[model samples]
Target: MLSRRLISIAGAFSLALTITACGTTTRQQVGIGTGAVLGGVAGSAVTNGSTLGTVGGAAVGGVIGNEVAKKKK
Candidate 1:
């Protein structure tokens, strides 16, 4: 279980990095990547390693991060 969670977290981070490195990432994209990382970590911790919680938290965080970035525009 622990290994699976770690793998998921690693995969999430890798995906975020890949997205960010795809060239010409805007503020919103950066926010999404950053938020996903933070949110996934937070969610996993808060939900006692629940995958659904991690994903939901990442989705929520991504939206919030994007909105916050938009405010600066």
Candidate 2:
């Protein structure tokens, strides 16, 4: 059951990325979006679908993504 749910989430995220691949976006934007999706998915799995967990995960993921995508000078 958990595997199926994760697969579904991955599939949905992939589809969304593919659909928007043609759009112009910064690396940071892409990173944040990817992180948020993955974080939300992970949070949902870890917390058994708890809303707070999902949101918290997304927030954390977004911050991590932003830092990761930062331009190094």
Candidate 3:
């Protein structure tokens, strides 16, 4: 039962990420979307579908991705 729920959550998250990623036109946008998707998946797995963990992971991942894709002088 729990496993099924986790799978469902992960699937939904993935779908949502894919949908959002479609509009990205820049490396940074792509990076953030990719990171958030990966992070959300990892977070869900680690926390067993805890909403806070998933959201926090996405937020953290977005920040990391933004930093990684940032233009440098």
Best-matching candidate per TM-score: 1
Q: Model 2: residues >4 Å from true position, as ranges?
A: 1-23
Instruction: Look at candidate 2 and give me any clashing residue pairs.
Output: none
Model 1 steric clash pairs: none
TM-score of 2: 0.69
Residue 5 of model 1 has an lDDT of 74
Tens-digit lDDT string for candidate 2 (1-73)? 6675566467547744874586898888877877777776777678876667767777787678778988999
- Show the lowest summed lDDT stretch of 10 residues, model 3: 4-13
Q: How do all models score by TM-score?
A: 0.84, 0.69, 0.69
Q: Which has the higher lDDT value, candidate number 1 or candidate number 2?
A: 1
Predicted candidate 3 versus true structure: per-residue lDDT over 1-73, tens digit per residue = 4775477467646765675667646878767777777777667667777777777777787778778888887
Error of 1 at 31 (Å): 0.7
Q: CA shift at 32, candidate 1, in angstroms?
A: 1.2
Among all candidates shown, the one with the greatest lDDT:
1
lDDT of 2 at 19: 40
Q: What are the runs in model 1 whose C-alpha is more than 4 Å off?
A: none
Give the runs in model 3 whose Cα sits over 4 Å from its true position: 1-24
